[model samples]
Target: SQQGEEDPQALSIQEGENATMNCSYKTSINNLQWYRQNSGRGLVHLILIRSNEREKHSGRLRVTLDTSKKSSSLLITASRAADTASYFCATPAIGGGSNYKLTFGKGTLLTVNP
Candidate 1:
C-alpha cells in the first residue's frame, strides 16, 4: 500500500490562529512530504521529513513523523486567510517500478476566516 493518509477531511480556523492535520500510512516510506494547493493554484511543497527524522520545521510550518507508529502530523501556526487551502500528505513509495510515483491522500480542506 502507499504511504501517507491525511485525516479530518476538512478544517475551519480563524485568521491568525493555528491549524493541524494528521496523516497515517500503512507501509514503510523513505520520506513523507506535505503540500498545499490554493484555489486555482498549483500544489506547493510545504515540508518533508525523512524516515529517520522525528520532527522538522519550516517557517510557521511544523511536521512530525513517527516511523514506528507510521503516522505524521502537520501544524501550521499563525495561519491567515491566505492559508485557506487544501493540504495533502505524500510519501514516495519505495520499490515502485520507475520510482517516480508519488501517492497522495484525499487531503484536508482548511478554511481560514479573515
Candidate 2:
C-alpha cells in the first residue's frame, strides 16, 4: 500500500531543458526520498524532505511534498545530458511494517539530449 508510483516511465529532453516527475502513493508514510540511478550504477541520494516540508531545493533540484494528497513532485532545472537516468521516490512504510524500511517504485526514466 505504500508504493510510490512515478508517472511517464520514460522522458526525453534536450540539453538545458527542465525535467519533472510526479509520484503518488497509497496509505500513509513517514518520509519520502528521491534518488537518481545511472546505467549500471547504484542510486545516489538526491534530496529528502519530510512530510512536514512543503518544498525543498538542492542545487538545481526541487522537491515538493503534499501529505494531504499523498503525492510528490520533483523538478530538475537546466538539465544536462549527463542528467539522463532513472529517478525513483521511496517512502518508509508504517502500520504492520518491518523495521520501517523504505519502499520504492519502478521509477521514471529521463533521457537528456545534448
Candidate 3:
C-alpha cells in the first residue's frame, strides 16, 4: 500500500512570496510525485523524484526527498495568484506491475493573493 499524507492542510500567501509544503509516507517507495489541481480541473503532474535522488527542480518548483525520514517537501518560488491550487504528493502502489497505480495524499490547499 502507498500512503502519503501532507501537512498543513491549508496555506495562504501573497504573490511573489514562496510557499512550502511537506508530505510524509508510511512505507518504502520507489519514487514520489507532486501534483497540482486547480479548482474543478484535472491534476497536473508537477515533479517526480526517485529514491536515489535527493532533490530535483523544475522551473519555479523545487522538490526534496529524504527516504530515511520517509518525507518529502515541495517548494514553490515566486508564487503567483494563478498558482493558487491544491497540491498533493503521491507514491506508487505496492506489488510488482502496480507502477500504474498511485496513492495520493489529502493535499494542501494553497491560496495566493494577488
Candidate 4:
C-alpha cells in the first residue's frame, strides 16, 4: 500500500521566494524520495533522504526527514517560474522487492508566479 501523503494540495508563490511542502507516511521506510513532474512530463528524481540521515541537499532543493514523526519536507530556495510543478513524495512498498517498487503520494502542486 502507499504510505506517503503530501500536505497543501496546492501552493502559490512568487519568484525568488522559498517554497516548502510536507509529507507524512503511515509506516517505516528505509528512505523517502521526492519527485518533480512538469506539466505532462515524467517524474524526475529530486532527492532521497535515508532513514539515518536527517537532511539532504541538491542544487536549490533541500529535504529533511524525521523517522520518529514519520514525516518529511521538501524545501526549494530561490524559486523560479520554471520550478513550478507538481511534487510528490514516495516510499518503498511494504513487501518483497520493496527496494525496486515505490508508492507515490497524490502530490503537491506548486505555481510560481513570475
Per-model TM against the reference: 0.91, 0.93, 0.93, 0.94
CA lDDT of each prediction against the hidden true structure: 0.90, 0.91, 0.95, 0.95
39: Cα error in model 3, Å: 0.1
**TM-score of candidate 1 versus the correct structure, residues matched by position:** 0.91
Q: Number of the top candidate by TM-score?
A: 4
- Clashing pairs for model 1 are none
Overall local distance difference test of candidate 2: 0.91
Query: Over the full model, what C-alpha lDDT does candidate 1 score relative to the true structure?
Result: 0.90
Clashes of 3: 0
C-alpha RMSD between model 3 and the true structure: 1.9
Order of all candidates by lDDT, from best down to worst? Answer: 4, 3, 2, 1
lDDT by residue for model 4 over 1-114, one digit each (tens)?
Answer: 678999989999999999999999988889999999999899999999999999999999999999999999999999999999999999987667545579899999999999
State each model's C-alpha RMSD to the native: 1.7, 1.7, 1.9, 1.7
